[model samples]
Target: MNTEEKGLGSWTEREREELLELGHALFACPELGFQEVKSARILEDFFEKNGISFEKGLSVTGIKASIGKKGGYHIALVADMDALEVRDGENAYPFHSCGHSIQTAVMACVLKRLKERGIAEKTGGQVSFIAAPAEEFIDFETRAKLKEEGKIRYFSGKQDMISKGVFDDVDCVISMHINGDSGGPLFDINSTLAGFMVKKVIFRGKASHSGAAPHLGRNALHGASLAMDGIAYLKDQLPPEAGLKLHPVLTSCGGTVNVIPEQAVLETYIRANTLEYLLEAGEKFDRCVTHCGEALGIETEIINTTGYMPFAQSQEITEVVHRQMLELCREDQIVKNVVSGASGDIGDLGYLIPAVQFGFSGAEGRIHSAVFSVGDEENAYFRTARVAEKTVEAILSDPSLQVKNPDFQKKKEFYLREWLGENRE
Candidate 1:
């Protein structure tokens, strides 16, 4: 493919080699969310080596670097740096099963190339490279502790970043994920994802010896099981268009099989295509679980945490990205209107700014699975950076590129109040 016509742009051989090397290094030493000490340091080292000034330790393990002199509009390229915790058989460790390593490597390369080519200066716009943390929403106990210590406010990385005003000056945002489906395009554009609310239910009861004093014990395990059943019965009540999803995992059932359980916990997420339906479903779930606990005469404590919102890419910005994507791949290699059942923190950012997220197909297994692996390094690492570079160029090239969602602040207010239960200042 002709470099200019394909929008691939030209990168030095050294640049390509460095990107793959970084990718391999990141993949080799995967770290979990909010605890990516080594991963953040590695990216910080890369920035320092490239003469790129950056701010480290935002949201504990997040980093931000700026490219191009301050001038016109500001665009941001966000890359989540945390890995997922996946367990298989007898082995379990933090792994890049979600392709975040590839995303981080590509984002770093994009900033490097933009600086090398003077693209940002020529286009007269500034670009921010944000390495965000805790996108996977795992390691809840640790995150809760961080919140208690006042080190972090939100569970998701982007939400915490927003709360800290990290994105106050950013006019537009772009990011990407991995699509493992072989039938899908090499690049999926303007795809939408569901929004969700996090739920943690703890059932408290008195413990007693199973065989000696069973009547004296109020079994929390029984209460949790009954709650799960109540939630399951709501499947038919949920509207089909709502795309409601309820998945619960029993984290703790009992201390031992012979003891009457004193406490049990259930962690779950209530997801829906629309925020209205999501909130409604979440309320019903809370009610259902509370009633289940009351029926069993056990005390239930419900902890509701804010989650991501539905993702809607800006039409104008999406058009710019779609045209550039067409230039980079064949017509058949571009997929539109892609909607997935999964959720992401990017959706939270999308509600506040003009944002667009795309995907590159270089993953071989289902997301969050042990078999997930990077299938094509060229496509995943190098080509993705190329597309990102072109997208930034497109945004910067137009000086009159005024982009904003009219409903952004309205949704932001609601998100703060409803999901976060925070009064607006």
Candidate 2:
């Protein structure tokens, strides 16, 4: 590896190449959340090849790999193993448009380096290579099935794992995601992400033959149209800093021109920065659906399956990573940044630990669209590994820095109570 002596550690040339190759493979095979079979197996193979042990079969597609054992202050590192559901020509329905595959590859590379250099032995603690599933919140039906079967109670991969007590032994959680553009200063930390809830609304009515007796049909399409109209009008009355977002996609629109529609399915995500904003905005959206359903004389059912809370980064952990990026990744590599109101499962972890989510961009394409591409050879991967290594060293070197979570007691207790299906009030 090209050594940049910034008082931080470096990676070997072999290490860099291995990381690059991992990125290439992972970027190519974009697996959706919860169904990241290939992605999970590939990472599992890498860990097995490296002689790291883990508690596999945790959440169908999630793997809890660990390094180091016995008594010490343990820290958890997460690499979300799922990709978004986007048809990018090569891979239909699932693709790496979000660049999480690269993020996972780099995380694996970091874990490997930590083991090869015996950093864990010196630190006297543990590190987890948690390949979490269903980070995208795309497959709701399957998640609902998993919950029904007692396989998982929570729909989100991270939330489910947490509900299963996966991080009980962990102190701090650290994870990074690939972002957009290069050379821009990466976000050192987030105050919190915008929180959101996933809602699936199904409008049901009586269908009739369009050409034969169209007037006899109870039009579910009219109800769906009204619901959409409400959403279009709702965009203006949202809070400024709260950052409300409403993305409703028409998943199904009843029937063909020959038939009068009986069912229309609409899936939407309601969001805001604070829980108060989230609840308030969600209420308005809820009212729109109910009122629209009433107006069209169609029964509408809403299902809220997933919720991603906001995350607040620990100044303690970020200062070290931010410093490493600044010194190691060229003179002006690291810059100040804030939360972009994106929703994620890491927020669930942040409620318990002082976590930081940071990374570099993989591709230059527009993020969620079909052209979302992972610029395979971006310097972000190697630089990210180096930063992680540097951060690990910093954590291991300092005794007063501490590895304990800031909100462990309160959050864990609350979640534990929730898991038991008890009232938390």
Candidate 3:
């Protein structure tokens, strides 16, 4: 057996089998954000089996669990519990096609070996594995309703957790995404992700019968069309470094074709790498909407969301992890720095503490597609777990690994102050 399968001879067959079963079980049960009944229960059961202790439901189905007596280094590991929302012939919601099932299972497996190695006892630090909800950011209407009912202040689980002070005491945090199985080039360094602005563009005018009174009505739909055209023009002006994207989807308009639609709602995701640049692009967007509304005599309300801070990995922590990766390197691989066009909550966490997203791909196929399957389940569950274990071991065993990354701290402090708009209270 490989070192990963054996867990350095620490993990047992029974434990590995249990972990594998948990993976498939999660795949079978798909839950949406803030409504993860089955997912939460399965995770809780895993903790119970492993003798890990945790507090339940900080903010709707989010479980905060910890192992080891060491609170000194107190690092947190995160795994999103919610599944993707693409219809898989279900009577209700979508499926776990994104493979969060693998992500959670792999983390659980790592936790097992960490226990066997006495990592918690030796490192004098604890790893809090959190099954955070709402990472997928699904169902805007339901999220809006929850916001109104005061059940959640924000749509995202991580943001809500941050608001509740879940991360106030944590030092560093990490999470793994199952990017299908592939060979090298799985992980990236200082991976910059897309920052998004969720906005609702409502164009309002007047409605009248289209047959005889076509000129009597001022059409909101026409104004929306103009706004989309303006947004499309941004591609040329956008900075290449911005990681920019403008996707405007028309959500609601007048129902009938005979009447001019008085009110139209367009959902737009305005994204970029740097906030300054994104803010600039946002100004351009606002101007375009403003022009469209004014020209069409339509009133538009632009509501921009509390967009997530960018995911900028700590170079210091990344450097340490890379060095450790080199020591653990196989002949087929080398640690690398890669750029990502995707935006995630991981960047939001970096605003509070240093963060890094190390990726692993065993095999490749269409991810998030209807026909998607794990590229190499055998290697992913076991080998990836070992990679996590080895990294955690280095962090605990090497005092140098515990050495602070000054650059990471500096950037982290900067963003935290910027995001919080003041000192953290």
Candidate closest to the true structure, highest TM-score: 1
Q: Where is the poorest 10-residue window by lDDT in model 2? A: 416-425
Candidate 3 structure quality by residue, lDDT tens digits, 28-144: 998888887788898888788778888778678888888776457766777778877775566445677677778788887677668767788977877778777887766879788
User: What ranges in model 3 sit over 4 Å off?
Assistant: 1-10, 69-71, 89-93, 183-190, 208-217, 255-261, 324-335, 363-365, 403-425
Q: Which of the predicted structures, 1 or 2, would earn the higher TM-score when compared with the native?
A: 1
Query: Would you list the clashing residue pairs of candidate 1?
Result: none
Could you tell which candidate, 1 or 3, scores higher by TM-score?
1
Candidate 3 positional error at 285, Å: 1.6
Better of 1 and 2 by lDDT: 1
Per-residue lDDT for 189 in model 3? Answer: 45
Q: Write the per-residue lDDT of candidate 2 for residues 1-425, one digit (tens) a residue.
A: 43564222456668777887888888788776667888777888889999998777788888887787756767677878777777656876777777777778877888888888888888886777788887886777877777788777677788878878788787777788766665455434444577778789999977998888978888888898899999889888885777888889989985888888999999988888776677688788888997898897899998765478766677788888777777655545444456567778887788777788875654677776778765535355766777776787678667776657666777678755642233532
- In model 2, what are the clashing residue pairs, if there are any? 1-12, 1-13, 34-134, 362-375, 363-375
What Cα-based lDDT does every candidate model obtain? 0.85, 0.75, 0.73
Q: Which model, 2 or 3, shows the larger TM-score?
A: 3
- Segments in model 1 whose C-alpha atoms lie over 4 Å from true places: 1-8, 181-184, 202-230, 248-267, 291-300, 406-413, 422-425
Model 1's lDDT to the true fold? 0.85
Measured against the true structure, the TM-scores of the candidates, in listed sequence, are 0.85, 0.79, 0.84
